[model samples]
Target chain A: MSPLSLTHRDTVAGPVLLVAGELDFVHAAELRRQVEGLVLHAGQCLVLDLSGVEFCDSTGITALLAARQHALAAEAEIVLAAVPAHLERILTIVGLVQVFTLRATAEDT
Target chain B: MGCARRVPADLNASPGPTTGPGLRSAPGAGDAGAPVGETWRHAPYPVLVADRRGVLTGLNEAARQYLPRAARGDRLRDLAPSWLAEAHHRLAEARSPGGGDVPAGHLGDRFFEAHPTPAGDGRVVWWLIDRTDALQAETALHSARTRSEMLSGIASTLLSTLNVPRCMEVTASLAAQHLAEGAVLIAPPQGRRHQLTYAARGTGAVQVTQQVDTRSVPGLAEALQGFPPVPARWLNPDDIPDWLIPEGFTGPVGSVIVTPLPGHGVPAGALVLLRSGTEKAFTEGEEAFARLFAARAGAALSAARLYAEQSAITATLMRELLPPKLGSVHGVEYAGNYRAATDQERIGGDFYDVHPGSDPSRETLVVLGDVAGKGLDAAVLTGKIRNTLQALLPLADDHQRVLSLLNGALLSSHQTRFATLVLASVRRGDEGVHLRLTSGGHLPPLIIRADGTVEEAPTHGTLVGALPQVRARTIETVLAPGEICLLYTDGITEARGGPLGEELFGEERLRRALAGCAGMPAEAVVEHVQMLAFQWLRSGGHDDMAVVAIGAARSGGPPTVAGAKDGMNL
Candidate 1:
């Protein structure tokens, strides 16, 4: 029952939002707001660091959609980093894992 | 209220001010005769005229049918039945001379809009238009708006729930608030009896906290005892026993809509919307809204279920990749722990495995590795490495040779692009226990002694598939009795802690944990180490960890591949 939390650190690649905690309906809007505030430049990459995330529900998925929209609106790209096993499975089942570029961490190619 | 106006037959009738002896017919009917006079009576409404003496002067065919009495010569005071005469008098006093058309009274479930226009002198023409359709349309529109608002509120409520049951309750209550009364009953039958649960509206005096068994209501049981549930609207009021109407449901009411809540396939339960007052009956529009909301509620339920199912599946899949329990060899006992990350969505590719090697009579092959990514990509890579390792065991007893084979397979195959791996095999039987190990950019295994000391097994090998000419080296060691050994993923070594990044649990913490638990049984040793790992991370051990613990079950026991079998995998 650790409070679900997410943190974003701006890297050379647009921004890297490291999310930890339950990304379910309760906190999804907060995550979306943070994503919305990101300044996406053309050709930049918005990396969603999910290494610390424990749970992600449909609302969380929608937040990711919002983040993707923010990036695409600016003609930028978005990627996922350190996606947890459970979240990855869900993303895969829903065919989202394929849509987003995934890396092990910031270091992984 | 005024003198009656006799509209001449030849004059063009006014568009709106419908008048004459033809205006007092039935409410919905319009005149169908006499060109000029017909137009006046056919002005899309019923017009009635009454003079100052309250004498009924004109009865248009259209206006004649709507009233109980349309006799031309009768006085208005006597023509209408007693009840209606009093109502008309009240209406006349309330009518404004220039108020235009407005609603007057409700009669027999119908609403009336009365428009009174003064004629020459003191006569008045009362134009009555049936407004039930317009009022009903307006009410329906309001109901739809209310339903949408309730749905939006439910969506907001769903956002805060993590526990599935609480989410379901919220969804059910949201649906209930828009249906039936301010309370709703959800009943799912189990075996011979149905378990009924109720949720009340956001604000109401009625507390919907009751369980009604099938036996308690004979009608409900009979309705349920069919292929498809008997619709509540079709149930005769006489057929329903008095006790079944719940607490507030009294006497005969409007139609009760019994819509069965569809399950995955079959009908799971019923949504009964009982209409009480005549005005409270469910319209088709309301029923459609209920169905739409029900579909959304079902989707939410399905989502919760999918989450749980995937969680269980992920745990199972992670377990499947781990080695089974191993028997004691010499004096060594073996055990291991595998955690597949905290993500509830996908199964990770981190895996550990143990099996027989080329020298079947003497050794057991043990492999541990973490796929570069997660989910299916990582899982597929793990699978490839695992299958290759298993296939190579019978072909090579040398650790470097086995590692070389894995590298070649990874480089040649399109399945697993690349991976980090550790392959180790231990000799069993009288020759003591000889450990042969190789690493492919994988975390090195740790050897713990009986004297409370720890060392990283000195073996560094090229990462598998990184290059075509990647050559790996093998390190050999002989383990004595009453000793412990640990092999794991970098998830353990990379854990961060302490103030200002001062405490790196790294190898030191792991060494201490192993040494402390060295004297315990193998499984207990694994658990103790795992507990330390969890504690060190302070956060459910970020990133999945695969731990293999090999120790002596009793004193003076040698560690062997048989022991490594249980320790190396999972």
Candidate 2:
């Protein structure tokens, strides 16, 4: 069980949250809290950078959906940047790929 | 003249000795019928008599010491350069018939109250009294009130949430905003040490520990010892540990207050508050307030830690209760899924397993059963039954004998628990896949023919576990290529709640559901039935559901039985 590490930075676009390690049940709530604290305005974007993510589970997927919902509620945009291949497969299987914007890197967003 | 004294030509002459409470009289001036002029000259308070022209006419000993440069006839403007202009304006107001006492004013650092009284012959008396001590007391009272209000705010914010990480986040945010310029909460090491540093941002706080050291910091060690808040001031950069400094933090931290957060029996962690250059050091009052805040945070952390531990334990047990993955078996397509009726923390008694036989016949044994109860008790019984069946798998050829042995084992245990289970033995020969099923008070298996026909397999037996001896009969059938069989728990057929809101998803309804699933793969067959059952039970209650579907290999497909082994002694 690899421990999760979260780091965040503010950019002209909005806030970008970087997640690493295994994003599973144990550390899903922490990511949720960090994302929930973000204050977004219309036309701003919140990007989740997951290039370093080693693994993700159903709970992790749920947290990502929650982040999307929060951004939508705030009338803002959300993008998943650098998502690992395995997580993308799961997202596609669960039919959530259509609901989120994907980018190859944070710079791309 | 009738006057007791005349004005002296030389005003600088020393005149009087103090000899009264309000007025000090000169040594000989205390005599009976002493002149009123001598008494007024030695008054204890500063007294200045200015004529209607605002010129100083007379002043006592106290006035000379307090003002230092005034002569009897000097103008008020020449003596007190800073205050005389304001005094002249105030004097004009005082001479008015309706004028009141002047408000207090500062003379240098000291405060004073000025009282003016009208006198005859164009002379006015002014008295000045010091008020420095009273002003100091008022300022101190106001500061104490502000500190306490901040303490209350910190307490309410820390105690508002019970989540452990959120509690720590709030603590860091509030401490940084109200108590210090930078704050870090060092949680008790979880596998490895890490710090959560929150620095004050515009209206919120940001986490800044991207590359922190995992080792315990110096102050944190002392804090974990359970001492009170320890204040460190004028600390050199070397004195501060590497873990406490956030990556890219450029500000110099001059001081810090580190306090222990005591949990149920031990300290949960430590909270470190940092201040930069020129910020006032932590006062005793603030340290007391920090302790109050940490106490509330400690309780919330302890509760959350305990909950996490219990959840971990439940997850471990559930993993144990879950049936092993149903791997591919020879000549059959196997798929199954189970959903517990309760939350994730609980284990349901609904279980199923497929064990291939060890003999040359290559027969495979499949079992699906539900214990009589729910929760831990049922789970324990299910484990026992599964273990016993694993030991009895060598007898797979004699289905009735294996069940009779299971029945005897349960009765001999003297336990009140019972179970309903279906046991099937499957083998492949030149004809097709052969299946023999035996039911011990369990539901009959549903067989779907390749031609879209669905019907219950003809198998029936007595219930197990209550009687000393039991009898069960076996029904054998051959599934041609593309045909499938499904065995399920009562949770499916007995489920209630449909369009009518009170009807059971009876066996007839299950048959109707399978009618449309012909020629489908085994996995899709199980999914279709499970989905229909779920839809029927929507808006109502359900029990645990478990299903296992076995299909014969298609005719043209390569044989799935090559090198296949037997019985997974589960």
Tens-place lDDT per residue, model 2, B1-570, is: 011112123311324332111221333222423222445576677777776677888888877777777787787766744353355545555654223334356655566555454454545556655546655665667777876787677767766666667777787777777777777777776544354646542334444334454234556676765666566445675677765754434477777777888888888778887776567777776767667767766777777777777878877876778876764566567788787766653467788888865542678899998776566767877888898999998887888888889989987883435577899888766676789998876778899998889978777665566445556678999888878889998778757789987676877889888888888878888889899999999877567788899888675432443355443311
lDDT of 1 by residue, B168-220 (tens): 56654664456765323344555544534344344332223344565443235
TM-score of chain A of each: 0.92, 0.95
Candidate 2: where are CA atoms >4 Å away? A1-109, B1-170, B190-222, B227-239, B247-253, B323-328, B342-347, B356-361, B375-414, B451-453, B462-467, B553-570
TM-score of chain A of 2: 0.95
TM-score to native of every candidate shown: 0.50, 0.60
Model 2: reference contacts kept, as a fraction:
0.00
RMSD of each: 16.0, 24.1
Error at B162, model 2, angstroms: 6.9
RMSD of 2: 24.1
